[model samples]
Target: MPAVTADTLTLPRIAPPAPAAQQRPVRSVTTAPSGYEGEGFPVRRAFAGVSTADLDPFIHMDQMGEVEYAPGEPKGTPWHPHRGFETVTYIIDGIFEHQDSHGGGGEITDGDTQWMTAGSGILHIEKPPEHLVVSGGLFHGIQLWVNLPSANKFNPPRYQDIRGRQASLLSSDDGGALLRVIAGEVGEHKGPGSTFTPITLVHATISPGAQLRVPWRPDFNALAYVLAGNATVGTEARPVRKGQLALFGPGDALTLAAGTSQPAAEPNLEVLLLGGRPIREPVVQYGPFVMNTREEIMQALKDFQSGSFGVIPGERIPHT
Candidate 1:
C-alpha cells in the first residue's frame, strides 16, 4: 500500500451477465407437413394446418422437391400471376430459373435466393434449368409467401436476387454455429435482401451442442422452420425435428441449440427463422393472388387476363 503502482495492483475479472434471464422463453407449437401436388412436382407444405391469421405477414411456406427427378422428369411451376404479396425462394440444391413478365429473368443455383415483390401484379415462371430437366439430379428448395401491408399492396413490382455469399454471415463464439441473414440483421451484420415490411429472415446451421442466440424485435411475430436435423429452441428448450415448423411466443431474443437435451447421434441443425411485424389488415387470397379484399382479387385476375400483368419473353399468346 506504500505506492499504488500499476504492477502492484491486481485486476479482478468480472464475468459477463447471464443471458437466459433476459432472453425470451421459447414456446413451441409443432405443425406437421401435409403432402400436396404442385404444378409438376410434389411438395410437402408445413404451413397448411396453420392459419395465416396465426402466422400474420407470412401467408404460406412450401418445401419443394427433395425428390429425385429422373431424366426428362424435372418440372416446375408454370406461368402464374401474383399480387399484393412477395415470394421468397431459397435454393438448397440443384438449379431453378425464374422469368418474370417484366423481363427480369435469372437462374438461382444452390444456396441462391430470389425475392420477388408482386405488388400490383406480375406473371412469372419458376422451373428447373434446361440442363437439369434433361440430366435431372436432385432438386430441392423452399418458397415462402410474405403478405404486404394494405398501404404497400399496390406498389410497383420489383425483384431482389442474392447469391450464396452475398448474405450476411455470423458465426458463434466457438465457431460451431453459423447464421446467414437473408432479410434481417444479426448483431451488426445486415442481410442482402430488401424488405418492405418490418421482418427478419435468417438461415442458421448449428453443429451438435452449439447454441445460437438470435435477437428479435419484441413486436414481431416469430417462428422457426427446421429444414434438416434437430434443434432445441427457446428457454424452455422445446425439441423440434426436421420437416417441422415451430412457432414461438413473445420474447426479445430466441435461444436455439442443436440436437436434443440428451446427447445421441445428432446431426447438424439447419433452420430458417422468420419474423415480421403483424399486419392486422384483411387478407383475401385467390389462387396465386393475395389481396386485402375479394374485389381486389377479382381485379388482379382481370388484369392478368387483359395482358397487363406483363408477359414472358418469347411466350406465345394462345388463340381462343
Candidate 2:
C-alpha cells in the first residue's frame, strides 16, 4: 500500500509485498541479528529482537518471555526437542497449551499466531494454561527462530495456526494508517503470512501527524521495531524511540513521523517488522542449544549427555 501525499514522510525499498496464501515464495532479505536477551518472571523483554551474534542460522528471538508464577511458582516450559528450525509464536496476551512431540496441540491468545516447523525432529511444550493457571496481567508475546536451508534441512515436522481472522489489516479505508499483517503481503490487502521462511511480518499504526509509506522488497532484509509512542525508521532521519531498533538499507522505505516526546493522547503507535531469506548457515551455541558446526556444537553437548536431547520437560531448568 504505497500512495500518500499529506504531512510529508515516506519510505520505499521494499519489494516482497505481493505473494500471500499459505506463503512459500522467495528471493532474499537478511537481518536476523538478535544476540539474545531474556527476562522472564517479572521480566518481559526477551532479546529485544536480537542482533545476531550467537544463534546464527536464526535460532532465537523472544520479544516477551514472562513466566511469573509466584504463588506456588513452579512455572513451566519444558519437554523440548528441535532440529534444523523454525518456531514462532505471537500471542499478545495470555493463554497456552501449545503441546508438541509433533502431534501438535494449540491455543494462543489475544492476537494469536503460532508456526512451528521443527523440521527433522520435534517435541515441544508451553505451559500456563490450565484455565489460566494463575494468570498475570501482561504475559504478552513474541517468539521467533528460523533456519532450515540446508536444502530444507531435513524437512519433516510442521505446524501453523495463525488466527486473528487469518491476518491482514492495513487500514486507511479512511481511518489513518494501521497495518497488522503478520506475514508478507502489504499491498492489495491480501495477507495471511505463512512462512517456512522468506518471511515478513508487519504491525504498524500511524496517526496523530500520520505518515505511513510502505512499498519494497528490493532485496528483503529490513528492520523496524518501535512498539510504542515514538517513530522514525530508516532513510536516516533518526529517532526510533520506544525501545529503539531500526536497521534499514535496501532502497529504504518506512518513514514515520510525530515525535518530540510524542504525546497527543498517545495516538496508538506500535511497530514490528521482520525479514526472511537468509540461511547463511554455520553456527553453534551452548545455551538453549543451537547447532551447525563446531563439531555440530560438540554433538549438541554429546547429544545432551547421551540421553539425546530429551528430558527437559518440567523440572530440570538447568542448562544456564
Candidate 3:
C-alpha cells in the first residue's frame, strides 16, 4: 500500500464570494424525508437501505432515516458497485466495518471516520461487526453522496480511515464552539479526511450565546444541518435547529450563535456543515444505483444483471 500522506485536509483560504457568487453557495436545502423505518434496530441494506434524499450536487443524504442493527441481527449490506461519484459514511453514535474491492477495510466507531472514493468503479460493502452487533447495542449513522468532478469520474477507487481521537479539534478559547474537522478545516483545525473533491464537512458544537465565525468557500455550495440545538447562519441570522437544514446563499462567512441554550444551562448545539461545487450532472438512480445519463444508468443495470461489475467485497473468502 502506498504510504498515507497528510491524511488531515484543511480548507483553502475563503476568497470573497464574487458578485455573481455573492449568492448563497448552497444550491438547495432538503430534508431526508424518511428512511426504511425498520424496527428498533438490526438491519442490512444497500445505499438504498435507508430513506435517502438528494440536495442537488449532493446526490443523496440518508441522515436519521438511516437504520441501525440491534445486537446480533442480520445487519450487513451485501455487495454493491458505485460509479461516477463518491460515498462518505459518518457515524455519530455507532460502529462500522467497511470493506471495498480496492483492498481496503477498517472499523469506525464513535468519533472515528471513514471515507470511500468510488472512482471509475469498485464493489463495496459495509456493516457493523457481528460480535459488536450481536453483543453490541444499536447501530446508527449518516451516509452522504458526493458527485465527482468530470475529470476524476473514472479514477481508481480509494479509502481513508480517520480515528476520532486523531482528529484535530478547532474550538474557540472563550467557550464559543467546537469545530470537529471530519473532512475539511474550519477556522484553523484541519480534519482527517482525504478526497479529490472540493468539500468541507464539520461537526460543529456551539455553546449558549456563543457565536463563532467560519470562513466560507465562495465558489463551493454550503449548508448546515442542525443535529442538536439552535443557531443562525449567514447575515440574515436565520435560525437553525435540530432536524432542520439551513441552506446558505452567497455569503463570505457563516455565523453560528446559540439561542436559549435549552436545559442544563447549556444545551448541546451541533450541526454538520457540508457543501461543494455543484456537479450539475443528470442523476438517474434506483436502489443502490446512481448514474449520470439515463443511458449510462441502463448500462449499469445491464452490468449488475450480468455480474460484470465484479464480485462481492468478501465473496472470495470461501467460507468452510
Candidate 4:
C-alpha cells in the first residue's frame, strides 16, 4: 500500500464542492472476482460484471496481487501483443520490469507507472527482476486498458515511464486523505502520464472516518474501486469494501467516506478513482486485439502472426 506517501498537511488541498454542485450517486456496486493472470499470478478482475457501455473508453482492468510471494515464487507475463489501446500499469509496492519490441523497456517500482500505447501493434513482456524472482516479496499493482477511438487506433506506439514522485499530490479538504493523481486533471493540478483519451486516474488513501468530496467532469463517467479496507460511496452512503467497485451516475462531483474501523493489516481505505470521456463506439475484442469491428480484429490477428508488431530485442531473455 506504500505506492506513494505524503504528509497531507503539506499537500495542496482539493477544494470542497460548491453548495450547488450535485454529488454523484452510486448506480451499482459489484465485487471483483478473484482470478489468475499472466504466469498464474493472482488478480482481481475489476470490470468483470460491468457493462462495456458504462466503461466506455476503458476496456479492462486487473488488480494484480496484493499477495506476499514466497522465495522463488514470483511470476510474470509471457511475450504478448496488443493493439488499439493503451496499457497503464501502476506498481504500488514492488518492482516490475517491462520491455516492448519497439525499444521501450524499464524497471518500475513503488508508485511508478508504465504507460504503453500498443497502437497499431507491439510485442511486450512484464516480469519480476531476477533478484525479485529469487527472493520474492510483496507485489501489488493495477493494470488498466484504455481503449482508443476509431480514428487513433493505428497511431504509432509510445511509452511513458511516470515515476511515483512525478505524480501530482493533493490532499482532501480536511487534510484527512492523500490523493495521487497519476493521469489527467484533478482540480488545477495535473499528473504526468498522457493518454489518447481524456481520463482522470487518482489513487487515494483515506484515514479512518475521513470523507472525500471532489469535483468531477460532468461529461465523464465516474467509478471508484476499493484496493484495501472498507468505505461508503455517494451521498446516500452505500457500503463498499475491498475488491468492490462502485459505478457512479452523472453528477458534478463525487463523494466517498472511509469506515471508522478496518482490518488490522489495512488501516486505511485505499481506492482508485477513475473517470473518462466516453468513446461510445462499437467494440470488438479478440484475445489481445481490441478493434471497432470483427474485420479489424481479424486483420490484427493476421498482422500479429505475420511479425508486423516488431522483433524482440536480442539482449533480453524471451519469456515463455
Give lDDT per model, in order.
Answer: 0.77, 0.56, 0.62, 0.94
Give the per-residue Cα lDDT of candidate 1 at 237.
85
TM-score of 3: 0.77
> What TM-scores do the predictions have?
0.87, 0.32, 0.77, 0.98
Best by TM-score: 4
The 10-residue segment with the lowest total lDDT in model 1: 1-10
The CA-based lDDT of model 2 is what? Answer: 0.56
Which whole-number lDDT from 0 to 100 does residue 152 have in model 4?
91
Candidate 4 C-alpha RMSD relative to the actual structure = 2.0
TM-score: the better of candidates 2 and 3: 3
Clash pairs, model 4 backbone? none
For model 4, how does the per-residue alpha-carbon lDDT over 152-171 read when each residue is reduced to its tens digit?
99999998989999999999
What TM-score would you give candidate 1 relative to the actual structure? 0.87
Worst 10 residues of 3 by lDDT: 1-10
Best-to-worst lDDT order: 4, 1, 3, 2
Best by lDDT: 4
lDDT of each residue in 156-251, candidate 1, tens digit only: 999887887777666655566666778876555678899888788888777777787766777888788887787888778888887888887776
Query: In model 1, which runs have C-alpha deviations exceeding 4 angstroms?
Result: 1-22, 260-266, 315-320
Candidate 3 per-residue lDDT over residues 53-81, each given as its tens digit:
33456766655323344456635566677
